[model samples]
Target: MVSEIHLSDDLGDSNLTVSDFANTLDAAIRTLLEEQSTGLIAGGKISNKLVELEIPEKLVVIGDIHGDLRALHNILKKIKIDKFVLNHNNKIIFLGDYVDRGLGSIEVLYTICSLKIQHPHSVVLMRGNHEAPVEFPISSHDLPKRMTERFGRRIGTEIYQTKIMDLFHLLYLITIIKGELFLVHGGVPTDLSNITMKFNEIVPNETGLFGDMLEEILWNDPRILPDGKDWENSRRGLGKHFSSNVSKNWLSISKTKVIVRGHEPCNGFKLDHDGMVLTLFSCNEAYPKFSVGYISTSGIRLHSIRNGFDLSEMVKIL
Candidate 1:
């Protein structure tokens, strides 16, 4: 019922547009990431350095993190997980967009994956649209390599290739929590009903396709502008692809009234459509793009996950 909420569904007889759906999906990624980032910071889980597996007091969700190992490190450090886990337990939810744009995505994901393995039960990893073969190569299809070529040398390539590559296959585009919060890398598609992202557990060669049963977790986002306000993301393909198209279409489908995402950059966490949707970019001051987000049952929060600025509390419910 919660995941069934979408704006497109309300329009019933109307057609869904890819442009709108893309924008909406992008925004959704940011929203969920914002939820995960600080949630990890406010970790109230019960894991020990030597022990494994424990219950969680809260869920820490992270937003889109391009290959910025530095920003990723900062986010992990900034999370006040210990503070939250004092009485309540907690878990970490990574909402996808883990690769591309920045140089260190390969390492970033591996680091997170390492954490997931170390803290197994406490970590949740979702897949983003960029996790495909087109994203990992050292050539043109790979933005991580391109960014690295412009920046400097990365610490480890083989480690990322071997260790992190395995996790990529196991990630999901969307991850729903307690059946209350819908977490996806992209926005939902119209007619998305009873769809689920099984990324909480990582396995080899598992995947979801695009269509009525679209990869909502990896495909959804919030609308870029207010109702009747047009927005264009040149960075994306002429505002027709998921960057703009699909988002609008999906927004109209869900019944939740509002969607969240992590693909775009915002001066800070933002709300549009009279609060119908929320957008939060998790990395700040990242090489090319940066944004971070934090979300919880109470509300959503935003923060800057970059090096220039010390990791600070971007968003907090309490």
Candidate 2:
């Protein structure tokens, strides 16, 4: 049975004061920094921008929110996340891209951050490419502009620099559900051999190999063509487009069955690389032609699942 989770009425409302917004951003930044310093431990352990956990009994997997506060709210209500967390063993993973491309980026960030503060153990926030500009700058970035428009120049600029940028640096890069699944904002690195070694102790802004790996995790996308090369230069200009064989080999190396990510816009969700990759797009406002959806299932069921095609059956489309 699902119980009701009452969200703040002012979350997406214009009535929310600038001071309140700043305070929430500050509180969230503090929470993330503290988590970074001390490590986050619920059932899983998060350290060095990587989250590792045993598959929970029940799990809710959300994709790119892209500032859709209504979508986020709907998912939370539909999943009964507040009630689900009461079990302590259940978890929810947000596959990044939380802000940008929509009108309510500030509200979306605030809501997720508030959820993290309220249920530190039950919620995991991963970093998306939209959240990667502090390191790998992208030309299409509009978050700063959105902030300035919403809160005015001086205060908004300060918030984006001090509060949001700091918070972005602290978001987790990837989450591993032990041998069950690999969750990231984008796609896998082309070189699977170095993954285990590099991901063990990753620094978000490091140069050379680690930097390259970070870029791929945040910007890459899976190549859907069956005959495509193992790796091809992505049209996105930053990450490589990996083929099905790469996905298979990477999964074998990581000991995970499926790669779950969110960087592409599709109708609800998409399966690529022979169902080895699941790309979920959960915001309709960003791509009006695309449907929004998320995955809600037990970790046990995920462990038994062989591919994204099978997993698609569990998606809850809104």
Candidate 3:
């Protein structure tokens, strides 16, 4: 059974220390786990492969956060959905990479989890490649290593296991909104048609699952199709490299109008395959470019961040 939870508002504040996250780790984990259980039970399905959500009146789709709390906060506040805007009519779909590379992975996660607890039905969290543990020699800042550096070995390791690891297991691979939009951390998988998989199938608990469709969803990249092939093996060495033709087929099969994903960074946002796919990067410091997407009756709106976290004009994706 799922339980209701309340976390201190301070957990959502930026510029937090590892100790701050450690103090609230247990409560946050309990709440996140309960939310996952409740959502699964209420959804009438036991699966991790996908999560189906009804498109709310107003929907916001954010790209890779990568532990940038200031960017997250700025985007949320600009859209008036910060810590207090808990209206059920509005929904936020985060494309993942909630940790790694930035300084505030702990606080970024706490804020997201707190939002989930407060608005259980309104927020949808998707799994990203960086969510799981990466091996040594990887370039970016991973959760375990960064936390250990900040909080010492024992406390950091425990905090990671209790607060971060389980949440990664609980996250879904894809979210289908109103049967019109298909959302995932990465692009489509070539093996998506091989199995008679339900909307929600069980996914692997960790990354590095070679050839797993769920892993593909979390790792794939979109590429323009060449002469006659549908897809080629990905250069990333894990997921498949999908082409526009592949995307069209998947869109037709799934009956979704467009695919929105985040994995590769872009100049705020990028439209592909003649507007059938959108890749957005929401973290400003990720590469000095940032934006967020909103799906409304008016179409997809891309809000760019400028002048150190100020909101710019809303550019419609065409």
Candidate 4:
């Protein structure tokens, strides 16, 4: 049997101090930086902002927490994360957007950081559009304001700039599970003609197309158009709205069957591109009408799965 680790009981604790939160962020950032420098994470290789993993025995995917501490706690409890990670072959991937729009942003981030620090190899934290503001600033960004409300002006602003921003910079942009699945916060890259380049070889911060690819990976969404158009400017004003053909071409070029992402709000989960893409929305507090959901599956099952529609049976709704 694998040794079990204990998680903190104060997930959404009301009395968490600024110092504690800062310390947790500091530890998580250090771990991520080390992973980047060494190019190793959870027995997988890291290339720039992409993580390449040879499918784990079990994988749990959580999407867009958005400061929903209760939802996070519920998912963790439902999955029995502490016990699950004990198996060593079990992994959990958080699909980013961990902050903003909810009252418990700090608490939610604190819990996630603590989890990452405890099980560095078992947890993968991917960057979402909300976390992309460090490079591509969003006008409606409110994580700093949430921090200020929680810890007062000076301390909150200090921590947000020093620790939180550093953490965001260290978050992974994409995680590819070998020949099985392509996991990202948003949708597929629009320019599939040049997508023959391996994802691991692409540098996110490089100028020109590489930079644009990073932006699209973090901000893009999927839509089915009546016309034959494959790409269009996104209303969000950052990434493009890619059509079903875009997803198919991208998946075929990347040698992956499905694109699992978290961006659009839906009733827990939604399938796009004729079941070629799976969009998971895991927080109810951010959009109360939508139910929170996550994907829990074994790599064997995921690898054998045909498309997103068949994968829906594995989603656990909260």
Candidate 5:
């Protein structure tokens, strides 16, 4: 039998070899398949698709890291100094796309997994478009190719199966903070209320059990239409690009203040519909500039990590 999930000891220690990763991958896959649960193991924290959080204290929200270990490390270093950010009350929410399109996909996965094991309740990892089980031909940089290049074909394939995509299914697609801020990998659905109740039913596997809704949540984008239209067909040929009015209607209906998402790698950050929607892209290599959002009692503050940590340009979304 696979050993109990215990990669928390490996955090900040990059001593794990590719073979070691393969072993961990095997164990994780066995754990996931056998348990048939959302948490890492049986009776663990987290559920499917939606992680509801109480954001009474400070919460650091990192946008898409892709696979840039450097940027991820930099953000971690800052978090380390803060000291209180990782406490039980607060949280560190990653807005997904943790793998693919960068050099350190495997390392990034290991790091995030370790952190999750260490802080099961405090650390939240959401599912991104790249996190889907099926291969995405659109990604310019394929993670599987990178894995194969690093550990050769056999070990790489094993890693991809268990260590990467399997865990993606366990990730919550939408994380609501204080029933106010909505966190999703992509834009929110036009009809947020209807889907919120049925989100757990939309589990994704190789066959895509609920592929259409999954595609919309993971692939959708936000747009501003001339009239007070709700949604329009996206140019991407995948999901709808919701209009400003759609977002407003959803926010009002859902009783949420703002919607935050990461997918388009939008020049580090983008605010739409008078800041009702915040799009943050945190991969520095793919997108040279990067920023992280902090949700607190004060409001949402966007801090730039481009040259260094600058909080002067913080935007209040409350």
Candidate 6:
């Protein structure tokens, strides 16, 4: 029979204190990291600790970075991106899941945090479902176990530092740009009221499973838009495509303005239904795979998204 949630009660000497966890977990992670070259893992562990950067022009948005630092860095160097959005307010909203499934999550967070510091007012960093503890359930193959299996205690402890925990606390952070555009990591929750509230109210841990209304807000996939205006849920994976129906619904709930988001990967940067919404995935499969995406809301003629990430017909954007 399969093991039944073998999570340990100890979590080693982490930077941030988790409520409950076993101790051996840190030892395992340290062993793994050492066996696999602790030096490199140590470098990656600190990648997401950046400080400052240039301001964005108008706005720039990125998608699931998935720890691909090479790809992320390449895109940053090539994009000549502006970090601030002045008139219509240009900013970069990382759709979510900045870490895992790849490498370099540390760097991705550092750059994002760096941008946050540089363009404090213009930088609108939001959270993805991956930020939720649920994403790292004891059953995960790469996390907890693989992470523990590699990366040793020192590196693992950093993963739970004040920086990461703080980010998780506000994982559901959002911004209703111009009171029209609702900028978020995933799709707006099925419960429209949740979106109407502040960012922390929808944070999973902070509010727990109470009347907080986060399961859907932080977890709902946009692909499950109502079919034929039926308002039904689709079986798309958590990485569901944002349906035109969802766009329509979000528009109505937020007053028929454009809804820009990042969750599922498109060819690269794409604009649908006459610029009503846009998606700019920053990471690309090529270039150490850093080809990232962004949006430019300048000139105010129509919303335009920019990116170094490309589409090779591998993704399905239902």
Best model number under lDDT: 4
Q: In model 6, how many backbone clashes occur?
A: 44
Better of 2 and 5 by TM-score: 2
Error of 6 at 35 (Å): 41
For candidate 3, what is the TM-score?
0.77
Model 6 lDDT, full chain set? 0.44
Q: Which 10-residue span in candidate 3 carries the lowest summed lDDT? A: 303-312
> Which rank order by TM-score, best down to worst?
4, 2, 3, 5, 6, 1
* Deviating ranges (above 4 Å) for candidate 3: 1-20, 23-25, 40-49, 82-84, 133-141, 192-211, 289-318
- The clash number for model 1 is 104
TM-score of each: 0.53, 0.90, 0.77, 0.92, 0.76, 0.58
Steric clashes per prediction: 104, 0, 1, 0, 0, 44
lDDT of 1 by residue, 1-318 (tens): 012212221222323232332233333444334433333322331111001112235556667776755555555655644343233245666766777766555445445644543344456666666764333232312643643343334523432344344445545444433212444555544332332332212112223333223333444344554444343333343111223333434434322233455655664356544443455566653633324455532222222221112122324321
State the C-alpha lDDT per candidate. 0.43, 0.80, 0.63, 0.81, 0.63, 0.44
**Model 6 lDDT per residue over 213-292, tens place:** 34344444444344554234535333334456556666665553555556556555565534556554656543342335
lDDT rank order: 4, 2, 3, 5, 6, 1
lDDT, candidate 4, at 241: 93
TM-score of 2: 0.90
Q: Largest TM-score belongs to which candidate?
A: 4
Winner of 1 and 6 under TM-score? 6
Off by over 4 Å in 2: 1-12, 192-196, 199-209, 224-228
